[model samples]
Target: MAIASMGTTVLDCPDPRTLAAFYAAVLGWETAQDSDDDWVELEGPGGYNLAFQRSEGHRPPQWPGTEHGQQAHLDLDVPGDAREEAERQVLELGATLLQGDDGGRRSFRVYADPAGHPFCLCYPRPQDT
Candidate 1:
């Protein structure tokens, strides 16, 4: 069967430009389109495109224990040895630790972006022997 590629991943946020800027800095992406207040697009690595939509009264997702639930989240790729520094960098960039960093028991770390959208900085999973 022929396969298809996902065009773009869109997220809902209060300010499209602000959200786009945050993502651009995090992912080292460039803004492809952000000339309007209602929508903004940040060009991602490869063909992956991320668009932020202006969501009125946008309520950020709650990690479990809540009815809102996690709207969606991004799992960022980070080298195993670089996770520590990455954690520090993301925190400085306004990410709030959500989970997986309480005692470093997990392979991945969870954080919420400036707009309260959740994302992760993960060490690459090892291949099964």
Candidate 2:
């Protein structure tokens, strides 16, 4: 028997509502009815729940460095052909590109959210390349 089933994935941020809003917009999710300023939850697709909690002294992780290494990250899969468009959309949505802009020749790109958390937009590798 399983001891416990999976629950929401919680992230600590300076402002829960703001971070939650960012993810909601990026994922096309809706804010949970019980969300508040200190704790906000997004109703993610496929019955998954992503939540954010306020941390007064929150410190964002530093990408590609161990000073404040990324404790966790999200990998959003995008079609190889649509990777460029996805990159543009994320940039417009307050995401800062960290790497993988070599004329879209790479299979994945890294970006930092408004709160400075690192995430990746991944593309499937070509089978016959």
Candidate 3:
């Protein structure tokens, strides 16, 4: 049997509540449980789960050139016509826009959550189907 079973991704933050809320909104998930102030979880769309744990001295990562560095990132796919609106919604939900490129009107934009974890919103590359 394999050791990994696609459980959950845990992120350490100074305040679990804040991080959990941010992710809950971002992922369109709801808080499934709040075991304590130090621990919280959001129920994923399917069977996935995301948890946040409080750390006394948590330091957010810095990305790119590493003035601060990133520990991990998540990518989400959006439809071409709705990409702009989705980006706006994510930013409104507390994600900081990082960068994007012009790939003939369809592209991916990188962003960082409030906890400094990087993520991307992308439009699927044109396929030959």
Candidate 4:
């Protein structure tokens, strides 16, 4: 009795192919065969899909501010032990850190993609016993 099932999540960017490649690298996904210049799709594991579409006047959002604030963002999980390596990989893959460790207090670090969309690399919190 649901209205519809899940579909691809699309991000508007200046160049679809380039953005798609970036996400593909970050997510370890593969580009769909039907992707093209104006629109590109990535086939993620578990039937999930992510896509990028060309926008002539795309403006990346400003995080932690009201002006052009974040419309949406992805929260990717990283194991506690691999957090440093994950951060290194993302930074090498064109992600810029917006916020980082606060004396080991926070469980997540914020970052912006090459196009300035904000996303977080979240680490698992210690469970109380």
Clashing pairs in 2: none
> Number of clashes in every candidate structure?
0, 0, 2, 0
Give candidate 2 regions above 4 Å deviation: 101-106
Query: Any runs in candidate 1 off by more than 4 Å, and if so which?
Result: 1-4, 125-129
TM-score of each: 0.86, 0.90, 0.83, 0.94
Ranking by TM-score: 4, 2, 1, 3
Q: 54-98, model 3: which lDDT tens digit per residue?
A: 989877777675776776777787787777798888888888987
lDDT tens string, model 2, 1-129? 999999998898998887887888888999999998999999977899999999999999999899999999998888877887988888888899998847657678999998899999988767523
Task: Please give the TM-score that candidate 1 achieves against the real structure.
Answer: 0.86
TM-score of 4: 0.94
- Residue 93 lDDT, candidate 1, scale 0-100: 78
> Model 3: number of clashes?
2
Point to the candidate with the largest lDDT: 4
Return whichever of 1 and 4 wins on lDDT. 4
For model 1, how does the per-residue alpha-carbon lDDT over 43-122 read when each residue is reduced to its tens digit? 76678899999999999988754688786789998887788888888888788988875555567888888888889897
Runs with alpha carbons beyond 4 Å of true place in candidate 4: 126-129
Tens digits of per-residue lDDT, candidate 4, 1-129, equal 999998989999999988888889888999999999999999988999999999999999998787999999999988888889999999999999999869568889999999889999998756511
Candidate 3 global TM-score: 0.83
When sorted by lDDT, best at the front, the candidate numbers are 4, 2, 1, 3
Clashing pairs in 1: none
Which scores better on lDDT, 3 or 4? 4
